[model samples]
Target: MKKRFRSTNPVVVGLATGLYPFLYNYYSNFTLVDSLGQLCFFVAFFLLVPVAINICIKIASKKIPFVAKNYILLLTLSNLVGFASLLTFSILGPKKKIILLVIVLVFLLALLLKKQLKKIIFLQYLLALIVAFQLGFYIINNLNFSTQWKQLPDTILEAKFKKKPNVYIIQPDGYANANMLKKPPYAIDNSAFENFLSENNFKIYPNFRSNYSNTVTSNSSMFAMKHHYYKNPKPSSKEAFGLRKSIAGNNATLSIFNENGYKTSLLIESPYLIVNRPKLGYDYSSIAYNNLSFLSRGFDMNVNVVAEMEKAIVANKDQTNFYFVEKILPGHIPVSKSGSEGKEIERENYIDNLEKANVWLRQMITLITENDPSALVVIVADHGGYVGFNYTGELKRKVKNATLVNSIFAATLAIRWPNNEVPEFDTDLKTNVNLFRILFSYLAQEPTYRNQLEDDGSFLIVSQDVPFGVYEVIDGNGTFVFNKVSF
Candidate 1:
C-alpha cells in the first residue's frame, strides 16, 4: 500500500476542494493570467490557514505529523466548513442552541478521534471539473472587466449642474408597483400612498419597471447608467461580484455626483454580500447591520434604519448640496396578511408593509421639504416581489411564460422635484437607467441630457441566453400592460 504520508494525492485533494467555490464565480471574469493568479493565490491562502493550525498542533503534541504527512485535511475542511456553514447557518443561525451543540459535538469528536479522522477525502475530483471548466469558460467567453482602470466617458462628466439639489434616491427592496398592489393575492389599496405623493408634488409612475429583478443587478446598472451585466454569449453568476464591486466602489453615478459637488451618502439596508463591501466616497454613511449578521449569512435585511437616517439627514439639512440613498424596508414580504397598530412586528405581510411604507414616505416627505424644499427625492423599488403570489388562481393564470409574470418587474417609481413637480416623460418609460439622465437633465439645466440617453422602450429581463421576460410596459386609466416577460 502507498504510504499515506508520502503520497502526493492529498495535496491534490486539498488544493482542489479549497478552490471550488472561489472558482465557481465568473462573468467573463478572468483571463488566463487572472484566473491562474486568483486560483494560485486563493489555494495558497486557504492552505496556509491549515498549515498554521497544524504547526500549533505539532508544537502542542510532539508526535503530531506535519502537513506533508497529513496533507492538512483542514485546508479542504475549512472550505467545506465555510461553504456548508453558510447554507447551514442561514437555516440554523436563528437556532443558536442547535448550532452551538452541533459545533461543540463536532469539535469534541474531532479531539477524540484525531487519528481516524485523518482520512477525510472529500471529492478529490472537484478540482478537476473546476479547472477543466474554468479553462473552457475562459476560452469560450470574453470578460469585459480587464485589470486596467477604466475612465468614465467624457460625455458623462461634460454636463455641469448649476444648482445641485439635495437628491435622495431611495431604494425600497422588493417593493412592487401600483399595479401589483391592485393585482391578485394581497390586493391592498395604494391610493393612500398615491394621494400622499400627489399631495407632496410627486409623480407616481406605476408603469416603471426595474432593469433587473435582483437588487445588486438593478443597482449596479442604475448607478453606472449602463448595463453592468458582462458581455458574454451567456450570462453566468461569476460576474456578480465584479458587478457588485462597481456598485460599491466609485461608479459613474457617484463620480458624477461627487465631481458636481453633491455630497453623496450610502445606506446599506439589505445585508447582501455587496452591501458589506461598500467603500464608496459617500459623505454620510449609515449601515444598519453588524458583523454578526454577515457571519450568520442570509439574503434578508431585517431592520429599517429610517429613524437613524433621519438624524443624519437632519444634520446636514441647511449647509451642503447632497445626494443621499437609503434602503428603507418596503415591506415586500409580510409576516402576516392581517395586523393592527400595536400588533406590529419586523416582518409584516405585504399589505401591512406597503401601508406602513406609505405612511413612512409621507413622513419622509415632510422631513425633506421642511429642511430642503428643493431636494430631488426619488422613490424607487429595487424590484417587484409578487412572484410568490403566483401560487394563487388569478396570479397563476396571469403568469404566462418564463419571460415574465405579469407585474413581477413592475416596481414602484416616484420622483419629487425641488419645487414639487417632475418633468413629464413619455408614459411608456419604465427603465431606471434613464432616471439619471432625466435627473441630470433637470439639475444641470441641459436638455441634451435627454438626447444623450437611450430611448425608453422594452428591455429584456434575461436569464443568460434565454429571455426570462421582456419589460414592455404601457399604462393608461389604471390598467396595466405587460410584455411576455420572465427570467
Candidate 2:
C-alpha cells in the first residue's frame, strides 16, 4: 500500500486568524472591508479547523491516541465561547443575527467531523498566539510614544479683562452663511439675515471657516484652541487607541476650560456625548432622548435636545452660565423619512425646523440679555451640509457624488459684544483658526491680544470635492481686507 500524507485544513485556520481583526474594524468603522470581511473569515475558520484537527490525529495517533477522542469536544466549546462573546458585544441588529447564525453553523460542522477537530484546535491556538502578539505590540508602541504637536499651538491665554462675561457658544450643525447658499433653490440672498444682525449690533465675520472638516476634530480643536494632528488613513489597532487618547486625554479642551474657572455645560445630540471615555471635565452634559431604548427612536435626536436645553435654561435662570449648545439641524439622512417627505415637503420641513430652533435660540438670547445685556453670544456651525448641487437638482446624483464627506460649508460667525465700541468692520474678515484666539481676546479684554490677533496670518484649508475658490468682500468704499473660500 502507498503511504498517505496528512495535511492541515486551510479553511478553519485562515478564518479564525482573520476574524478578530475584521470584527474590531467593523466596530470602529475603520474601513469598507469590515461589513463583509468578518463573516467570511469566521465561516472559513470554522470549516477548516476540523480538517486541521484530523491531520493532527493521524500524525500523533501512536503517541497521543487520547487527543483524537477529546479534540472535537474542546474545539466545539472554544468556538461556542468565541461566537457568544461576539454576539454579546455586537451593536445588536439584523447584522448581528446573521453573524450569529454563521458562527453556529460552523461550530456544528466542526463537531460533525470529530476525527479532524484535533488538528483544527492546534491551528487555532497558533493563530491566537499571533493575534495576541500583534495586540501587545500595538499597545506598547502607542502608549510609549510621545504625542506629536504638528499643527497646534502652545500656551493659549485669554486677554486680560476687567470682569468675567457670561459666554454662550452656539454651534448649529451644517449651517452655512447666506452668500454661500446661492446655488438656486437652497440659495438665499442672506441679505435679510445680515441686515437683521446689523440692526442688532452683532458683528458678523462673514468669512469664518471651520478648523477641521468633521465634528470630532473641529469641536475638539475649538475647545482646545489647538490644531489637531491625528490623521491616520489606514489606522492600525495602535492608531485607534491613539485617536481615543487624542479625543479624551488630559490635554483636551474641557480640562483647560475647567482650569480657567469656566463652568462648562454641553447640550449635544451626538452619541459621542455618552461615550464612556475619560472625562474631559464638563460641569454638565446632556444628549437627546436620554431615556429612549431604541436606536430608531434616537433619529429625531435634535427635537429632544432642544427641549432639554429649554428646560435647563428655564430651571436655572439665576446663575451666570457658560453654555456650549450643539444644535442638530435636519441635515443628516432620514431627513425625508423623519415624517417629512416630498420635494416641497422636505424644503418646507427643513425651513420650519430651522425656524423652530431659531425661536428657541432667540428665547434664550432674550432671557440672557434681560439678565445681562453685556453677555457674549458666539454663534457658529459645526460643519455644513452636502445637499443637492442646487436645491431642485436630482437627490440621487448628488448623493452618489457627494463631496469627499469631509468638505463642510463655511461656518457662520455672528458675535454680539455688550458695552464696547464695536467697530463697523464693513469688509469681510477671513477668520478660521483664530476663533479661539479671538474668543479669548474678547473674554479677557486685553487689547494686546487683539494686536496679536491682527498679526496672525492664517488661511482656510478645505479638502477636495468642495467648490474651492477664494472670495473677497468689498465695503461701500471697495476695500478688500479679507479673502477666503466661498464654500
Q: Count the backbone clashes (under 3 Å) in each candidate.
A: 20, 15
Q: Model 1 — which ten-residue stretch has the worst lDDT? A: 26-35
> What lDDT tens digits, residue by residue, belong to model 1 across residues 229-301?
2323243423333566556667777777878866776665554524334454566546533442433233455
TM-score for each of the candidates: 0.70, 0.58
Of the candidates shown, which would achieve the greatest lDDT relative to the real structure?
A: 1
Cα lDDT of model 2 by residue, 293-390, tens digit? 22221233343455655676676566656777776663422323334355444445555555555565565556556655777777777554433323
Assess each prediction's global lDDT (C-alpha) against the native. Answer: 0.53, 0.47
How much is 234 displaced in model 1, in angstroms? 1.7
Off by over 4 Å in 1: 1-46, 63-119, 122-143, 146-156, 228-241, 271-281, 288-304, 331-348, 387-404, 424-429, 458-487
